[model samples]
Target chain A: MSSTPSLWRRPFLPARILRWPSGKATPASAVYEHPLIVRYCHWLNTIALFILAGSGLQIFMAFPSFGPKIPQHDLLHVPPKLALGGWLGGALQWHITFAWIYIATGLIYVIYQFASGNYRQFLFTSSDIKGVWPMARFYFFRGEKPPAAESYNALQKLAYTFVVLLGILSVWTGLVLYKPVQFSGLAWLLGGFHLARVWHFAVLWLFVLFVIGHLIMVILHGWNNFVSMITGWKRNPDYLP
Target chain B: MVEPTNNEKLAHHLARRDLLRLSPLLLAGALFIPSVRSKFITGGLGVGDWLSEAIFRRNHLAPTFSTSELTPFDQFPLNTYDVNDPDVDFDDWALTVSGDVARPGKYSLAQIKALPLQRQNTKHICVEGWDVVGRFGGARVSDFLNLVGANTSAKFLYVECADDYYESLDMPSALQPQSLLCYEMYDQPLTREHGAPLRFSLPTKLGYKSAKYLTTLRVTDVIPQKGYWEDQGYSQDGGI
Candidate 1:
């Protein structure tokens, strides 16, 4: 409601606040929306996530079933092209290796978001609930585009918040599967080893779905939005005054 | 409003400079280069091994299932890299013990079984992701190590199987109370397919680490041959 930006909302780097020859602000100026650390973590985590998913598929090919080993009933076959490592051992190496990268990037991102209080940009809250239906209508039913008052809309905030939580769940479930005995208490909380495997697999599919939706939105939003993530600036964001 | 040309140029320069700041991330692309790919993969795997080993608790036990939860004996899986039944001379079969031990000699199954027997219903988890809970009975490996006067401080316990399958265990894992020189399963003598005579039953490690058809057991610090699957790129410290 205030014209002045909050301390957390201010760009880490100075924004290009341009003025006309008459000293009036112009829309041609650029705002630094993403911090350097945020962009770094984003690209690195993206690469790690893809590698994890591909190698995970290869690992699943080892036992493709949630049933008993003796009477093994394969649930589904993941195509070799969709998989990363050539074999089980090879897949395990990739999975374990990238798991560290994935965890590191995720941890850094979450810590930075909280420490800088930048989480407000995408954290969904009760205030966001009223904006959701309007954004959904505009996106899905060609309704009038809602006025952009902030960096992210309600729907975008909801999706980002959901995916971040999903990322945390993925890591927890993965640990349970990797060392069920060592994390026996956690495994028990998730309904034992067998159920934990199921939950991990389910989390993978949800991640795949989220990635698909995210890609579609990125393509629709075009280069301006995409460039903001890479170069940390948006030339004419709708939210800019 | 039309921006001045100099202002536009400044924005362009700032964006380019910001993009260049992320050039260090381009190093990640080195993973695509064939020459260095294996090194990265192995290095990553090594980190994973180091972390797992660091957190391993020697006394912390793997979970045990109730009798009713045990996987039926008939349904228990027979997993082997080679022949399911590696023909061994049962009459002459004795675990040859060597390396850092006061009594480095052949130990008969009778000698191992003579010690206090332990029965447990523990889970057997495979690297391939399948798992089963089965009842296993054996003498505590620690008891045998004590009887043989083994240097418990040794870093590794290496074993070679009749099937040519070899495995090594970290001394801490080797000394777990649940670690056993297993000779029985499902309250019956181990079948030929299940590494009869002598084998390892370590609930804390993956299935492959519990090598079947035991022929030689050595207490040592150096492992010339890590394990059958390990040499093929599996983690050496395959702790569960």
Candidate 2:
């Protein structure tokens, strides 16, 4: 079932996802991560992103100064560069290699979700959206947390939304670093080879931000959330928070 | 009794409301939460292959090399600059075998290659997190063991490279079908940069243990004589 490349051309998804329209309530269990294939993409993205974070950090440490190098390294005491290029004994290679596979896997994933109905019900919602203001009020203001998100919390919705949109950016920028000459247009769009690197370095930081916050949310919520994904078990109550 | 009944109803309503609010939170957790993002986070993969190595047997499988991310010109560490370098000789290179064998002596590259050639397509695992699907063609070390009638006493197979780097596989892992004394890649002799003369290719183990630049082999019952990574934090069984 996995081998055919043509399946990607016309991804198959259940009709239930297609039938639903946005804003109308779809039970979280009914549409949120129902298919095992979509769930697999979630797991793969989560894992691969963090792996990139760690290994990318190891590589980006090769140049620590963030944001344009306007003022020279002559004045400030800066962190020394770390290169997995050869230093971590090929960690960089593994990062890029898995990234290619990760990209392919995500392509399969998004294609499936887009073909199905959940993309509108779960992912594309902008009701409260995960804005910094809502996030702050949810945490500090003891607010109701934006009427309880459908498939994802507002914060999650925004984070994933941005990530989904930037999917091409991440892979392209990474490629510019991996093989600058091969994908010259990407490098050029990223503002030359050196500028592409600057963005690459910056994205690594963004990933770190997402991860630390992602973890805190997980811990605060507890194992009920964890068990659902691993076991594919969801309890049905009359209402969703 | 009426007052008490009224209080109980109020409490029940609150509890029911909480349950209503509790479920989506539960579902979200499953969709978003993951405990460990990476198994190779700390220092790459430490020998997880030991399990597969013990359970499965194949002396012919070989992982392809096109998958190996090209090492840049600046980063490629080529040990042998010229054939004439005094450190080694292609003609005189010998793979010596000792311990747990009826005949323990060095065999020249020609003699080793002269053994039966075996080939198979197997997965090459990288600790960094990618797998290479390729083919390796060479003679099975098991075939070599059978030829010389290796004594049953030898429980470990120690393969050492000319570079001081060393790795070992348990007798069971060593005897796997994908395990072979590989001499050819992509229909050409394995290059020196890729452990050319004759290297043992076990598709199941992570790339690190598949030592390149082969120089010697020893079959022993001892356990400490394992690959360098095993001596460090890496797990002893380097199976995929």
Candidate 3:
């Protein structure tokens, strides 16, 4: 498939570009799109998220049923195949341990994003909102040409921003569930433990959806995306700033 | 569209077609096998419990709350059986201390309450993810163990409740200062709705570990095989 001449059926769309400091070892010809700190946090997040998902599923499965009880009512339940943490004890252990890692890495990522001023690249401005429809059309409606510009497209910015907010919500809800008494005020603010639990579980499914979309987009974008994440530099000279 | 160079082609580990075909297999593996699934869910899970257990000192007490912080009574009612359950008989109740104790015998409620009494205001953490502060008055589990001359070397304290509920706590938790054989709540005799005659109030454990309507105490060297919910897959270490 790689040898099949054209990876894109149409001319490659231009993307918004951001210039970041390059490592001394990096060649001047290629742009350093992702810094080492970003790469490290991204990979660490991959580990933390996966563990949390499994253990969280395990915890959820202990009760298995959700929502108000009305006999014969259709309530959503996670199938056993999708659940992690074989037992309640095992799941709690996994969940608690990874929760620390997830929180730590998340903090570092936020700090670095702000410190390095890379956060600007993720800003979704009014213009970005206007661009969303066109971008959606370009992807879904085959003949439309994608908007050309810089580092990340408007849709990418919107999605990434939403995900960041979602991550924060997940952690907040998790804490409310984990220590309701200590965080009683916070729990009450979110409408109590049961409501917080529903949000937590729903956010998990949102993450699953996000993962699916992220993988598909990366695949469509080709090896440049993976290579940039892994190596901290874009391989395609044309794709670089 | 730009053509991919030889290096770029080689750099690609999977073609689009291959990824499409392999995705299903990856999903199935994640759903069935822990080892393969854990590749996606990677962490130091094997050492987590060990580390937590090691760091979780026996004397480390759960946070205490004031009487003001005590959870409202009507809001947090009895969880087990309702007030009318026939299984609980408070009128003819006696606590039988047996197994590895030096003196094995039955003691009435009046006799048990006659021992040195203590009161504690501690958080009652529930495993289902809620907590409340309540004042429990009773003999310290350690003191009761001593009264019965329980075998100090025993590994577990297996307790049975009149409600047919059973629980087993580890030796260390059984000896924790906060662990109590509670006979009173809110400075009043326990209501029938609560664990009437007696119950174990272990601040270190989740609500379930504090068995209500407690009827029997068995000091044993063998690790308890199962508790009512532990058999149903609840965490044995019900600690926070």
State which docking tier applies to candidate 2: incorrect
Q: Give me the runs in candidate 1 sitting further than 4 Å from their true place.
A: A1-26, B1-20, B23-25
Tens-digit lDDT track of model 3 for B1-240: 999988788657457545543443454455467675444333344343244445456776666777787776655545673333536666778899989988889988887887889898887766754456788999888988888899877878998877677888877888888888898998998777678778889886778889888888899977566588766655566654
Weakest lDDT window of 10 consecutive positions for candidate 2 chain B:
B35-44
Top model number, TM-score: 1
Every model's DockQ: 0.62, 0.02, 0.09
* Candidate 3 per-residue lDDT over residues A1-241, each given as its tens digit: 5654343233333323444456755443545677666766676677678878987887876554454321223345667676667776667766876777778778898787766567666767686887888877877787475645666787788888888888899999987776554456777788866688889989999999999988987897778767887666665444333
Off by over 4 Å in 2: A1-52, A59-241, B1-87, B90-93, B119-136, B151-154, B189-196, B228-236
Query: Which CAPRI category fits model 1?
Result: medium
Which candidate wins on DockQ?
1
In TM-score terms, candidate 1 sits at: 0.92
Chain B of model 1: TM-score?
A: 0.90
What does candidate 2's lDDT look like per residue over A51-99, in tens digits? 5665575555433443322231322332334323333334553365457
True contacts kept of each: 0.74, 0.00, 0.06
Ranking by lDDT: 1, 3, 2
lDDT by candidate, in order shown: 0.89, 0.58, 0.72
* Candidate 1 chain A, poorest ten consecutive residues by summed lDDT: A13-22
